[model samples]
Each structure stands twice: as C-alpha cells, then as structure tokens.
Target: MSPQPPASAAALRARAETAGLHLPGLILAAEQLAAQVSPGAHGLRRAGPGEDFWQYRPASAGDGMRAIDWRRSARSDQDFVRDREAQTAQTAAIWVSGGQGMAFSGASDRETKAERARLLALALAMLMLRGGERVGLLGQRARSGRLQAERLAEALVAAPAAQADFDAPDAGALRPRQRVVLIADFLARPDWLPGFLAQAAGLGTTGVILQLLDPDEESFPYHGAVLFRSQSGALRHESRDAGALRGAYLARLAERRDWLAAQAGAAGWRYVHASTGDLPADSLTELWQMMGR
Candidate 1:
C-alpha cells in the first residue's frame, strides 16, 4: 500500500487551537497526577522480569555466576544473588477525542472537554508508565517508561481536527489482552459502537469509555431565547424557551448513557462518565481501580 499523506500545517494548527493544546500545562498536570496516586496503585505487586531491583537471595548451585551481586557479596562471606522486579506490564491504549464538540466549555472556570480529555489521557499514561505498563495512543505504537506521556502529548497536538470523528482504531499492532481507554463527549449517537466494541473484544482488547460532558449539557441551564451553536458548524438551533427543552434534552442524555453503558457491559468493557467541572484526578483514580480489576 502507498504511504499516507501528511496532514497540512493549517489542519494541525486548527486541532491544537480547538483542543487548547498546551504541552507545558499538560506535563505539569501529569506530574501532579502521578504524585497523587499511591505508588504501584495499579495492582503491580509481583516482582519478576522487570528493571527495578526487587530483592536478593542467597546463591544456589543453579544460580549463574553473573547473577551474584559482587558489591554486596564482597560485604559478606556468602554469595548473594541479584533479582530484578518481575515485570507484569500490560499495554494501555488511549484515545482522547479531539472533536469540535469537545471544544465547548460552558463556564469561564471550566476547562474545555478536549483539554480535560488530553490531561486525563496524558496523566493516565504517566500512571501506566510508573506501573511498568506500556502506553500507546489507540492508533499508534506502544511505549513504556516515564517519558512516554510527553511523546503522546506532542503527537496529540499535531493530529488534525478532522480526524476526530468516531472511527474504529486501526488495530494492526493491537494485540489480544490489552486495554483501550476512549475519552470523548459521545454527544452523537454511535450506532457503530456496539459492533466496533464487539470486534475489539474478539481481538482480546478490553475497553473503557470515559464519557465527558459539559455542566451545561447535563443541566440545560439556559432559560428564554437561547441560541445554541454546533461546535462543528454543522447545525444551529434557536430555542425560544430553552428551559422548556430541558426535560427532553436531559432525558435524551440519560438515554444515551444508558445505551452506552449497556453496550459496554455486553462487550465486557467498563463505562464511566464525568463532567468537565469534576476533578480529573478523581476520575483517573476510579479508572485505575477499574482497570486493575
């Protein structure tokens, strides 16, 4: 197959602007998030096949001469063996939607959903790295170590906004038994989600959906003569009495969540929702526990 063409500079600029792509702030947030989580919070307790030092044991006949920790052995008459922590790192694939809808932030104090998604995505990646897990974007190569999150942030900012549509990830490198986390507003009805998730499960990928919502979207807090604009510039609707639509709007929202949750459950995937006003740490902590299970 021919190689794919690179995205235009204009498209890259648009995605960054819409997503409020701030690398410095994102890095800081990821670091802070890492600090908040207790070390090894992701159920990574076993010691084997890892880089970090675990413990040393007395040398046995089967032990290789090279396995001896000479520095420590010199301190004692008996030979001791060196052992590294056993690595049980799993791959976590993340996708934070850069859709135009994610650009909407209802209040000045609130962060846009896209920015919040990126923060959570990167922060989670940091946590995964600390746990000795491989981290990757949904359609990208997996990586490990402390700096993987930084690289992901750079790639995220460079992606074109037009590529934000809900599409099944290219699973060429996606192996069986890996985890996939999808962060999105999910405002539109995803008729394809059920099949996509089912196929993902068939491929041995467990899924997690983090549905982001704006506070105003959940509450429909507007009253009297409200003009609502589509973030994608696809539609415009004026409400003479926005308050009147609250009941139907909220009902529809609830219905969507219900449907999504049901589909996720059927595919053995986890579903969680959060508002932009909610602290990212809380949601991430919850997600960590879920993924651990």
Candidate 2:
C-alpha cells in the first residue's frame, strides 16, 4: 500500500483549520502546539530546524541557514552544519478498531464503518502531523517519522486493521515523554489495553482514546434469528433468545461504557467518545489540552 501524499505542514494546517466548518465549535488549531510527543529514543521532531540535533547534512535549499554548523563546515571545508530540530512534544499514536464486530455497522451513503474509521484515522493523523507531532499507526503497524504519518492513512485505506495484540508492548526507544491517542470501537473487552497503557505510562506517557461506537453496538437492536460476524476482535453469535437477554444486554453495555471511561480517567487518559457521523476533532483538542500541551 502507498503512504499518504506528503502535504507540507502549512498546507495541512490550513486544511485542518477549515475542516470542521460543518460543525460549529468543533474547529481547532494544532499549529501553535509545542513538540512534546516522542514514542522512541529519537526526539520526534519535524524534518525542519528546531531544538534537538536530529541529524546533520550538507546545507541545501530549504534548509534553514541557522541549522548549518560552522565548525563542521570548517573541518570539511564545505557547507556542512548540524540539522537541529524541536523535540517531539507529543507522540500521537492512533489505535483503530478493526475487530470483526466493527463490520456490523453497515455502510452509509457510499461508506461503511470501516471507511469512517479510515477517514477518522486520516483526518486525525493529518491534524497531528500538521501540528508537527509524531503520528503513527497502532493496531496495524506502528512507525514514527516526519512523513510516516501518511503511511498510516494509506494502510487504513488499503486494509482493515488487524487485531491488536494490546498485551505486546511496542518496541524501540521513544522520547522519554510521549502521548498516545487511540481510536477504536472497543467492542470486546480484549485482554490487551491495560498492559499497553501501563508500559507507555511507565515511560511518562499520557493517553487519549476516541471510543467509536456504532448505534447497534450500544443496543442489542437486532431481533429475530440473525447471524453475525465479527470484524477484528473475536465475537460471534446467532442469538435465538435475543429478546429475553435484551435487558441484561443493555445493563451490561452501560456497565462496560462506564467502566471504560473510569479506566481511562483513572489512568489519567483523555477520552473522546463518539458514534458514527459525529465530530471528533473538538474533543481531540480537549484531550491535547488536558496533557498540558
């Protein structure tokens, strides 16, 4: 699959500035945010000049003149200088739910829940990348780089997310401080979330989860003998007694919802809960603000 088109930070910021016009009060600007997200040892800096010494290279066009290290240039007797950049203020890792059950949410207009997930994934990735934060895919393949943000969108567009092994900690050394932003339906209580978050938190990581709930998910709205298949997570059922279990089902769903919120809150995680056809950016900002970014 192809990585997303590489849009300059300015172009991306401009797009985000105008994206949520459909919903008033939902618009936000990530441009002014400081770089603090680092998911690995290398500071997650934009491929431009800032604070940390990311790498050095011979001076070239578009390279900030100040980035040239004169001492190195003198030694080589060439135009060589240190290419310093800002420390990644945040590591915005995105977790998309591709559990088998996510497919239950049927298509709308020309899009299915899968497409919506991809859209959210791309939009948020762009927002974070635009803000100069390091953005990466979580469930599918996690990566962090200036242009790697676009890879995530293309992956989502090319394939549905594979089931996430939340228990498996991400590898590689990230910046000491990082922020993780998750987007998922969280349908099944998969046995992986707590472990993942704990590991990241150990490294001074904060989290934000955008719970994407489908309408039918909250309600066992299906009646009659109906067969269902799961999307990413493992859950299958052909309920004949759905009517009788409706009350218990509702109660259980409510309990799960409350528990999820409490868990995230207790862990100092920012939660942005949404359903299909809903707005996600405004709440995303709220979470970014909460981490003191």
TM, every model: 0.77, 0.57
Q: How close is candidate 2 to the true structure, as a TM-score?
A: 0.57
Candidate 1 wrong stretches, greater than 4 Å: 1-21, 39-87, 163-173
| Tens-digit lDDT string for candidate 2 (14-60) | 65555434122111122112122221233435555455666767888
Candidate 2 lowest-lDDT run of ten: 25-34
lDDT of 1 by residue, 101-159 (tens): 88889998788987788778887788888877888998788999867877888877665
The list of candidate 2 runs beyond 4 A from truth reads 1-88, 107-110, 139-149, 159-175, 232-235, 279-293
Candidate 2 overall lDDT versus native: 0.56
Candidate 2 global Cα RMSD: 14.9
Could you tally the backbone clashes for each prediction?
6, 27
